[model samples]
Target: MHQLTDCQLIQSPDDQAAYTSAINENPANAGTTGRTRRKRSLFNYSKLWANGRTLKIAFLDNPPAAHKQKIIAAASQWLPYINLKFVFVDDEGDIRIATGNNDNSSMLGTDALLIHPDHPTMNLGVPPDHADFDVIVIHEFGHALGAMHEHQHPQANIPWDKPKVYAFYQNREMNPLSKTQVDRNLFATFDTLSAVHTAYDRKSVMHHPVPNSLTLGDWEVPINRRISKKDKRLMRLLYPK
Candidate 1:
């Protein structure tokens, strides 16, 4: 992965524009591709030493208590695999809460953070009331627990059709990327199959949405949802009991 300094150099306005254009032309190329591969350490569970101690987790209060329960349940299911002892705390001292902010969620020192009470997304007026809550909570918690995007795996060899991916992200107005973005994304070392990865899973809960047209080239899947076997193995390795 490009060092933070290198990343800064490419952050120049002209470079940014060029990078944006490149990404707009091919979203799949938003990560490392060739000759940028870096060696990574094997994921070793021994590295994460919870010491048989139950991890204390706390969620700042949010609306629709049911959604909180769902988030907790999802996280719980994945906890054992990581050999972690976890329990949710009820006091604010345990986890701070902000009504409409999630940016600081990771600062609590806890393993995960759920949605804020008044997030715009929750206010969208959907029937289920918590339509995207589960996905968001699970995905973010995956990060708090040290997961990274699967599409960005160092060993990945995505056949990104740059033109198609760039067009899709451009239409969506998501962060525009460049070859540097791609190289930084691909070259960074990972501990293991990130908890974020779904095994070649297009429907994996962690997979980000990419346009169908981008799947035509060397890209293998259209979407991803469930965590992959490789991901599970990596988790076990990272936090093994």
Candidate 2:
């Protein structure tokens, strides 16, 4: 299974065990300064409705009141920084959220519009304590808000140990991913995903915590629970006055 990342969501086929990890970070905070555009641009164009302005979201099967409230709160954290508003609806919406056992995923921005309405483009896992809960909710919402994983930034220079990285996910207890899957989800990077960006922010909510064991040298990021300073800065840049 791919690790827990801010955004690298390609819903796994696993229905029971959330074949998602908690260590994966996808930052296609890619190189936009040159030829690249922004990680979100790597995907197809937004379906317009999902491109700026008010964006509507829905919860499939309707989570419990408490869970729903928490989801709203976590997702709304970005509202103050970006010029985006999230409206929770009962009918067709720009983004739809579903629940899985331990997996959390989301389609980046308007990509959700292409999927069938009956299918969920976003999946939230079982809620944890405040820290994990907030991180998961906000990170997934970050994808909904057009932010990609920060680790995948083309300029992100993370020194990963191939063998150890492969072993880490394949041996996971939940939805374990194969070497190929791990490579695609974790070691993958984008080419032309540039936009208003900050220096590669290891603390960005889009990044996953890399354990020291997974890297060759002394490289690692702890499970980041808060949105980094640059994250807000980039959001403002993406939706400025």
Candidate 3:
């Protein structure tokens, strides 16, 4: 995580305009587009109980103890709806510290997060403001439970102003224009409205806030705070009867 100053946080209207422009200017994603033919729901407890296997999760000792607690609490909210037990361990067993390298990818046998102790945001002194530890934990755990990125929803027709988003990320140094910055299969199709969705929610614990510069163009962001209807529906479906 990068430490962003208050000034950096304050994205100006002009900046927003420029970001939208960049998004629109960027070339359309070339790979397969549209919804995935095989739709997978978020969490359906009943079905999971019948067919799903219990998954063991252990967090590497990178994040602070407080941060770990927050992650657990957030997970508890959804655990009752799903049919798996989440276990946390102090030692590096199934999951290990995130080295930020591609080689150590399978630290967690199923799904897990590796926090780099040296990362500016993960380390002390950095404000724990933008990235909600609990939400991030739950979102990552969702992946461990076989959920994919909601933004990659196949049916999603994001009205991204490519140039604008690119410019916004560039200014913030969060740009994913190049293959290194963005995954090649990012635009590949998957059904976003499936039961596993955290709702069409921008504020859900599963969602990341769009840069202010790119908020205007066809992006539906939430004003208040709460999970989206879609999130609830998906959770029920994934863990349902």
Best by TM-score: 2
Which is superior by lDDT, 1 or 3?
A: 1
- Please give each candidate's TM-score: 0.54, 0.79, 0.54
Q: lDDT for model 1, please.
A: 0.42
Worst window of 10 by summed lDDT in candidate 1: 1-10
Residues 1-241 of candidate 1: C-alpha lDDT, one tens digit per residue:
1111111111123434433433443332234344666642123111122334465555444536665566566556667567667676544322232324322123211212222323221111111244454444555445444555555555444666766655543454334456555444433434332423334434444445454466654345543335556656766765667
Local accuracy by lDDT, each model:
0.42, 0.66, 0.39
Per residue, candidate 3 scores C-alpha lDDT tens digits across 61-150 of 356767566656765666765655656665543323332321111211121222232321111222234454345444544443435445
Q: Which regions of candidate 2 fall more than 4 Å away from where they truly are? A: 1-8, 11-52, 128-131, 192-196
- Provide the global lDDT of candidate 3 against the true structure: 0.39
lDDT for each residue of candidate 2 in 1-241, tens digit (9 for 90 to 100): 2236423565334312221111111122222334654443323221112224677788876878888888888889888888777899876876888865457888755456556888777888746444578888888888766676788776678899989888877887767679888867777764422233456788888888888888878988988888888888877765664
